[model samples]
Structure formats: structure tokens, C-alpha cells
Target: MSRLEPLTMPVPQSASPATPAARFHNVEIILPRQESQAAAQMICEVFRAANDLFPGAPYRTHVRDLATQMRSAPDGWKPRTAIFLGGISTRWTLNSGEKASLQRICRQTPRCLFAGSAIFLLPETGLNTRYETAVHANFAAAAKEEDLPCAPAGTLTTVSDRISTAISSFAALRLLTTYLREDRGAFIADAVCDYLGLALGPTADHSRVSLQLRQAAGGDALIVKILELMQRNIEEPLLIRDIASQAGVSPRKLERRFQEKTRTSPLAAYRKLRIEKARQLLLHTSLPLTEIVAATGFGSRSNLTEWFKREYKTSPQAFRKQYYAEREPQRSLA
Candidate 1:
């Protein structure tokens, strides 16, 4: 079993300089009654990642609950885009004031997005009477009963006029990335997706070779399956021979296919995946160095640091510090 050698790979660079935009777009994430806090936080995390990668802080996000109807948005708080997260119960009732507030916000905002069960709000608020909505299968019957215009079966998301709807929270993430790609560029959107360990999806038209090898694996079914196995077994990496056996190919064939498709050996590709996972945990999480090493299958802090420095040109601690140091001022302002 050979180990991955120290290879210096250039970090993904932004296409433009870090200059502030003329004006930041305000985005309001509305939780129409009780919703998943984790879902709302994930949405905000995407925006934050975009802000970190892009030149300027192009978006300012606010999480508001319609359960506490304030009658109107606060002074000087004009949201350009509003997103309604899904998790509310179909039977959960809303009063006139809440419904009115939802309607008012939807009418005022230039763009609106509904995720998961939040599609129900479309008809309830009189916003999507004429447009087809991407309703989750779990809520399809309910949506039909409520007279909501449901899109065709298996539709993940749909956009009509100024409104967009998604069938599930995962689809909502992809929709948000699509919006980001339009607002920013493919570089920024793909970079953020790479950092979050998310697929850039079929809509991405970027030409950069992604650090996540799965993105560049092309149409090789064997390579794709092996890459997925590598991703799933990050905490306890599998040996090349074992992986080959599980993938139903000989070790020699696995190595040949990986090299042909990814231009890297099986062991090297596996190491890269683990290193990338370490990078994500370092930036997006508060886990300590030892925990990160253990989780990424590096076996020791020194090993993790050596490969992390080789891949990212910085030690894990320094990388984490530099990233958050740059983000602290933005947090204070927010």
C-alpha cells in the first residue's frame, strides 16, 4: 500500500479581485410558522460561503419567522429576495394576519423561493395561482387537495415568473446554487459547492477541474462508484485491494481505470478525497485537529498537517485561523 506523495496543488482562485459591490442584495429567509432551524442555518451557510469566496459581500441574509407577524418589514430592511423554507405541517393553521404578512412579503419582494412543504404557502398566499409548483411526493396529495398547481411527477424544482419552488430541502440547496451561479459566476458557485462537499449539478457550465475528483470522473461508472465509496468511507479508509474487490474489479484494473479517468492512482485519489474532507471540517466546523485527523483517516496530526500543507499550502490551524480572521469583521457588521 503506497501513500500519496506531497504534491503542491494551487488553490482555486477567484476570477476577480476582492472589490466591494455597489450595493448588497438583502435576502430574507422566512420560516412560515415552525420550521427546521438546521435547514435555515444551512441556507445561511451557503450565502456565507458565497460571500467568503466572492469579491464583495453581495448578499445580506435575515431569518424571520412569520409566526410572529410584525405587520411589516423593519424600516431600512428591504429584501430583494425572499425564501420560504419547508418543514411546516400541512395541518398547521395560520391566522389571517400571518397569511397577510406572507402575502405582503411575497408581493413586495422581487423574487421568492419555496422549499419542501412550503409550496403550500403559494396558493394560501394567492401568489402562485397560475404557476406550476414542484411539490414533494409526501405533500403531493395535500397540495392537489388544496388546489395548488403541482408540477409533473418527479419534478425536483420549477421556476415561473418571479417565484420558484422545490420538492425537497436538498433540491432547494441546488436551486440556491443556481441562483448564485446567475448572480455571481461559475467559479464562485462551484468553489462554494466544493467547500461544502456538494455536487455542482448538471447546470454548472464551468471548465475548471474540481478539487473533488468525483466531479471530473466523467462517464466511467466504475470510477464514479469507487469515488462514492471513497467518500462514504472517509473515517476508515479501505485498502486498494479491498476496494477493488468490493467494486468487483481487480486491483490492477481499478488502478488502470482511475488513472485513465482522473489522471491519478487509486490510492492517490482516495488520499485526496480524505484531505478534501479534512479541509471542509476545518473551515466549516469547530472540530479540533486530532478529531479532524481521525475523521479523515490521516491517523495522526503530523500526517494530516503534512498533506494539508502540501495540498493547500498552509497548515490546518493556520488555514482555519486565516479563514475566520477574514470573516470576523463581516460577522460583527452582520
Candidate 2:
């Protein structure tokens, strides 16, 4: 499995020039609740700092940003993202101007997104503000399909309001310093790619993207069988036609509907699946190169190396090295 890399630290509220890609995808600041006066003040401070940094950039041009119930927004906060999911049991209110809170909601069912899926839910955004997170990463090189508009991740309602104090504020400061010194772009790109590949699938392309099916029990059953077959005989040099026959679909139709939906051809997608698995084993296990090749369904080590390089721009050995060296440092801390 690929790992998620967080930004080393939050950026200082100072002015600095960075690419759009580098500017975004480097930080994931999860503000679970911002309803209190303290929350409002904290949000204001963040905005003031951002305004001081980039005086001209607009904020909150998108509607999703203004979805907050608050009447006023922070000085420089840009509400520039829209999120689309299968469905969200929205928190609604009544006509009496009293807040309406609902009970008995299904919580925490992890949503599964395939590779190359893309959705744009903000076709109608009325607010006008720019949005940016103060973090370091190369958001540009991280492919576009992976950079869909992000939605609020956690449940809107929480039961408790107990714990106080900023969580790990001191530790955050130290990490931020180190991150700025490092090649934050590469790490950020990795994080961004992981997010994209996760939502779309391992080989999703931007030109082709689709919405994820929310509750596809039957589709999921088919996915399991297909994935099992791919995993069991990855090195068989099988064609899409062969796989489709096994999957109960005609080659041409699969090419049309499935490939269009996924933005990647069946063979390419399967190769990605195999390579990703190969990548995992190569990094996690002490298995030899030949064994890894056999395990991932490559005909030979050379074959694996060639394909891995073509897709990832690095040899298997090099990929293993980078992944481990980059990953382990982050992992041991967690």
C-alpha cells in the first residue's frame, strides 16, 4: 500500500513565490470544528497572515467555500473547492431560524474510488475568494486527475467538546522547519499522487474521469473476482480479450464502456495493478528480484524492470530504495 505524506510544517504567514502545484497538495490541515469564538479568532488570524502574504490573489471564488453557516468569513480565506461524493446526509435546519440537527446517521463507511475517476461538483459557485494552504509540496507535477476538489472529510456533527489546547502545536513547528529545508516538492507530489491514485484507481488519467459508484454490491462482487484472477496469474501475458472472456464481457464493449469510464485501457490498468503490487512486495519484503518478478507476474526481472521504469521512471531497485528511504523515516514516527 502507498503511504500518505503530510507537509513538514505549516508555512510562515510570510510572502513567498511558489508554483500552483507546489503551493497546494503539500498540507492537509484538518480543522474538525470551527464553531466557537476561539475558532473564529483562529480562523481570522490565519486569514490575516495569508492576506499579508499575497495581497492581490482573490479568495473564495467557489461556492463550496461559502457553504459554512457563518455570516462572515476570514479576511483572506478563499472558498475555492467543491466536493462530490455518492451522497452526504447533510445537516439541515428548520424555518424558525433554529438549528436543526439530525440523529441516526450512518457514519464512517469508507468510500472506495477507482483509478482515473474525476468529478467536478462545483459547476455553480457564487462566492469569490482564493484558497490556498500554507504547506510545502510540488502540487504541479502531481497529476491533475489526482487533484480533484476536496470535500470536508469527517462527519459534520460530533458528540463531544471536551479536549482543549492546540494538538501538537510545538511538534508542528519543528516539522514545518525541517520540511521547508527538504525537497518538499517531491514529497508533496508523492502525497498528491497517492490521493489521486486512490480516488481514481492506480492508473486513472485526467482526460478520462468518472464518478464513483456509492453502493455497488454487485459491481464489488465482480471486482473481487477480477482482481483475484489478476493477482493469481499476473505474469501470464494475458490479453484483455482473454481477461474479458474470463470476466464475461466482449473485448470491444469492454474497450468502449469500461475504458472510457476509467480513462485507462484494461491492459494498462492491469499492468498498473501488477506493478503496484510488485512495488509493495519489493519495498516491504526481503524477497529477491527474481522472486519479486515472479510474484508480480512479470515474465522476467528484465521485463519487470522495463515496465516499472516506463511507468514510474525508475527501476525496480531504485524505486524500492527511494520508497523505503522516504517511507521508513515517516513510518517509524507514526
Which candidate should be chosen as best, given TM-score against the real structure? 1
Worst 10 residues of 2 by lDDT: 101-110
TM-score of each: 0.55, 0.38
Model 2 compared with the native: what TM-score?
0.38
> After superposition, which runs of candidate 2 have C-alpha atoms over 4 Å from their true positions?
1-232, 235-238, 326-334
Cα displacement (Å) at residue 23, model 2: 10
Instruction: Please write out the lDDT profile of model 1 over residues 1-334, one tens digit for every residue.
Output: 1221211112224423343323666787876554545557788878876665453545767777675634645665556888888763453346787788887887778889988878867776765467799988788788889888889999999998788988876788888888888787665677678667676454432212233354456546898678767777889999999999999999999999888888899898788778878988998899999999999999999999999999899999999999999999999998
Q: How does candidate 1 score on lDDT?
A: 0.74
List RMSD in Å for every model shown. 11.9, 18.7
- Model 2, residue 214: displacement in angstroms? 11
Q: Write the per-residue lDDT of candidate 2 for residues 29-129, one digit (tens) a residue.
A: 22112112232232223223323222223121111111232223234333222111111112111222111100000011111111011111111111121
lDDT of 2: 0.37
Q: Which residue pairs in model 1 clash with each other?
A: none
